[model samples]
Target: MDNGIGNWPTIHRVRHPDRIALIDAANGAELTFGQLDARTNALADALARKGIAQGDRVALVTLNSPQMLEVVLAVAKLGGVAVPINCRLQAPEVQYILGDCGARIVFSSPQTAPVVAAAVEGTDVSEIIEIPSGEQRAAGEASQSPYETLIAAGSTERVEADVAADDLAMLMYTSGTTGFPKGAMLTHANHHWNAINNLTAVEGIGPLDISLAAAPLFHIGALGIFSLPLLYVGGTTVVLEAFTPDAWLDAVATHRVSVAFAVPAMWAAIDATPAMGTTDLSSLRYGLCGGAPCPVVLIESLTRRGIRFAEGFGLTETAPIACVLDIEDTVRFAGSVGKPALHVDMMVADPQGEEVSRGEIGELLVRGPNVFIGYWNKPDATAEALRGGWFYTGDLATCDDDGYYRIVDRKKDMIVSGGENVYASEVEQVMHRHPAVGEVAVIGIPDEKWGESVTAVVAVKPGADVAEAELITWTREQIAHFKSPRAVYFVDALPRTATGKILKRDLRKRWSADGSAVQR
Candidate 1:
């Protein structure tokens, strides 16, 4: 009985080999527990034969597919670190991550092969594996060896590696808000306990429950909280390559998905879709909304339909789940993110790191086995973030006497647009590169659809002309499209403090006061 996550598939294979473990909704493919276990064992052997040793980093830049899941499990079995890249990232951003992580091998789908090729051109990545879709290529039209080929050629005999609970399992990259994205080193224990917390948070989940993975798999909220936990309990996971309202609703109705997790924006979009009303969603037992503050109205709407919504709070540094608004408390604590998860300790602290009184606003700090070990190769950042044995979440929150916690504001300048984290500094850096831009400040403004929309307030250079559309387009080309500003506001000068720091709160107020922010 291996104590690490690497053995989960093997355990389930022995217990329930005939159970369906995964269902690829896009292609209508299924993988039983026995099949998944055998495939992952073969893939692990193939990776070891390719010189991928324990503790080495392997990057996967592919969409939602069974192959992606296979790669994740295979890496775990090999005692290697899995770095799942956000498929929406631009080439430059992807290149930066690959270089930073020192990944020796990268697996990308044919759809994203061009971007992956460009990103790894100058990086340390030595081997590139192309995961082809089920469609077979014509004879003599073969390119690089397909993912299936590796699985077919390798042996199914389990490749055992010395793995422990404390060993590093994953390198989850945070959205680089200030500069480059930092990799949060999550151990096997961190992920194991996180799965336990997720299971405990939502009671009554059993082997018969089916979960939907509609959100991007790169995110911990989707993979860690939803998919992995369900797998631990021998439930089936239905995966979608990308989120679409029609596809999500259809999967739920078709697969009888009992549990699902999505960001607030996704929930909003699903509600707007005509299929949402027509589709039979009675099979869904509950759903989770997180990544940004979910609107109370959205929660109420979903709850009215008998789809219980559990809002949660956490970060990449905390294995992505520390608190969850259970279904029982959703109505009573309508606006809260709920109390700390099982075995997780949370506190509100002042600037001096002292715990604040109940009902007082302060930074939220968490301590638990699920907390990540530290940022990969970033000692200073790791030390600063994990001070006094607590992970500083950089979120301003208040805890009521009833123990419910509500987020007040963000201590860090981050924008949560459509459930994706866009660091104000990362967007501002690209905006400043425009020749006509003299100064730029990025802030998140309240949005109805997206929890918060990324808005850029800019001051044009003297005697230069630049349209808002052009600036937005320029920024999109530099980073992921989601991080690009959805609205642009022109200003004569930005308000700054005596120390020459731009007052973002004032900019947010100014934009809110007047209706000058132009949304595209």
Candidate 2:
């Protein structure tokens, strides 16, 4: 197929016209591909009427719903950039994103109105379209709010924009290791290219196969690597609002879901669930596991269940897929992230930035067509990360002689605990807000159960006193539950380099040496 022939709207317009597109389990509503196209066209017309033009950024704060999918395609059709905000983000974090991206319109769920209102306050965004899910209608609509009224009113059909394949389609923010999140610019071609690569990796999907996409569509892993491929193959997608063991199993058996993608933590829950033991999972062939490393125990458990599970590694920069282990190679490359995808070049580089020898761990660098254009507005960060035409992924790994890559560590102090990413800087920021905290550094400690647990080393103000549990409790109240540090070390001072950067490696080493420690 021609690269220009892969624009989402064009692809949907031509192929799978009568096929099923979206189904809302919450409301028992379904939209066929033809109906989806019409609805998205109506939404595109609605967006254009609201002064949203090509290259405009529209922030979306909603859950995994049919409307979310519609708005995504609508944004592409209207030539606008869709910024899907993490629905769990707090007000301050949401504000930073809206202001940073210069979003003109924020379409959010009714539940998120308060935070969305605060985020876009005093901004250029004069409209907040609140989309109510199910049967609930949100209260406190301002006089200028035309979303509920207009969407209910007859939608005026408008001509779709001739969106070029190269037109920017989405702006996804990376889970920043330092400072605030940076927007990664991805074009329609990037989405199409990566989605195509993902499809080829799998043994083709058919209309008879149903895919359970429980992962949030906001993440590129779910959108680009999972959902879009299923759509391209004209397969059925069983969407879930959230991941629950019972819900997942029921969806699979109830919908006869044949394929799905899930993280390691979710698999563990499924294994432990009584429902999974009795429920029929024979419909599922296998799943693509990513976001975090899959443990040997979890892999064994899935294997025993006759499910073929594979691993892959990528960041938000590489359209979220640089390498994925082939299902055929799962036995030989059991713990490896496998080799790079076709049409991509991946290598391990040492500190000197030279390619490392086989079986040697080094920073992984990947060059591929799927890589993003650059960060939205941060030129320096973009240049540093994407130098010499290779995207320097801040992940450490080793490539075996068989060309399988195994991650040894992360170059940055980011922790993936329980499938939710916990950036050290974000946790440290919460610590800094405490009056008793003088300094702090957070690191990931290997855990047999949770994979990696968030551990924090804190230095209290000379005269003030703070307990470890107190700090943990404070952090829990401040941020999301999964992000809170499982343990906190009250120290006299934190290890720092000459230039005053906290040395997380030193802190990890110290904890290893001192066995007599409080286990918060």
Candidate 3:
């Protein structure tokens, strides 16, 4: 059996025992590669002792921390799958993921312990491991004691993983415009190839390189984009508990972060930060932007500051890296996701999966080892998404004359707010629960701060009236706040197509311009 990526820590430990593997930004605590390997071995043994063996599901729901990755690697070492839950999700949303994946153990932090507790109440979760947060212990909280005890009890002997290249390693949950979220099954080889693609796309990524894990690790953007790839390449990763413009700037300056990846919204925030001028960015050799269309202005702004900013595009199903723009071509081809990665094969194809002519809008399809294996336990979805060895990305794009690709539209009509994917249908499902809501269509309105703001265009029930604030608050109670509508507009009736389908495009067009919205 192939050792797979589970052996990364062990290999690096032998290769660079004294090298720093991780830096917890919360408190400047560092873990050497040797210590990291020993900890992962111990955690793996502890998990095996708890009845978690190969192919078992383990969940992690916590803020960004070095321990989060430690748990992921430990589970990987045991040939188990790690499910990282979005901390922003409410109990039901969290419960659905935990139950869907049938996770038996969960990792939580002091800040997110309550939500984790509520989410695992009726699930298969039998054990909860609280990761240290470097914060004062909350009332009734034993912050780092649980993990410390487990590590102490577990044997530190090396555990060779019994996994294959295509064995499922992670089940990443991503929602579509309709229905519940689907878990994308990523194999160990998929992640390794993605790391190679990133290393090849971004030149000079090696042991000397250090990256900041600023985005939430639950999202593939932060996990696969830079941090994991860096780890695969024996580089150091700095973990952040949360993202703030000040925190981001401080990480780069203090850690001498050589490479960083963040969404365009974050880049915009960094651009707007007053300390951008004073912060010592001399160590930042390269910056990558994705998760949304990057404005050329932002690229130019960063370039003007002497920071090379490149752009790329992909989805959770693609192991998150398919197309990439080299740092040299970032400003020249602004607004474009550059070309497909050196190892990835991409084509703009018609509905029939046939390639469309250049410059013609069509669905973007990608085929490569980096693509995910399938959706967890959903063969029908797996079949539909992966046909002819190409993952049909429901994104409208066109290949230009210069062989560049730009995303024209999100075919799923998904909303990306502040680097988070908010499915319209999931939010709409909650919004429809409101007694006053008759019909509603959720849309994303472009915002300078957040890449897009979730907006609701609703036609209330006849003779039933509700304040916008009331409806917004109602949705927040029922769903994650990030997915809730930032602005609610009242309409007499929702525009529809001949088939009675909601015309979301027209709603977007009507509200996207002039930012005109009705409060009631």
Per-model TM-score versus the true fold: 0.80, 0.77, 0.80
Candidate No. with top lDDT: 3
Candidate 1 lowest-lDDT run of ten: 134-143
**Candidate 3 TM-score versus the reference:** 0.80
Q: How many steric clashes does model 1 contain? A: 0
Please identify which of the two predictions, 1 or 2, would achieve the higher TM-score against the true structure. Answer: 1
* lDDT by residue for model 2 (1-520), tens: 2232124434564676777766655544566766766667677777777898888999888767667777777777778899988776788888888888989989887677888988887677878887665334223332234444554442635345767777788999865435578999987777777776776664645555667777777777767666766565565676777678898888888777777887665776687688877887777777778776665556766777777777777777777778888777666666678888877899899877799999876888998788898998999989988988888888778898978888765677668888876766557656777878766778888776887889888887668998888889998999998888988888777664221235576677666544664544
The lDDT ranking, best first, is 3, 1, 2
How many residue pairs clash in each candidate at the backbone level? Answer: 0, 0, 0
**C-alpha lDDT values of all predictions:** 0.83, 0.73, 0.84
For candidate 3, give the lDDT: 0.84
Worst 10 residues of 3 by lDDT: 135-144
Model 2: worst 10 consecutive residues (lDDT sum): 135-144
lDDT of 1 by residue, 397-440 (tens): 88999899987657766678899877675576567768787668
Off by over 4 Å in 3: 136-144, 175-178, 414-520
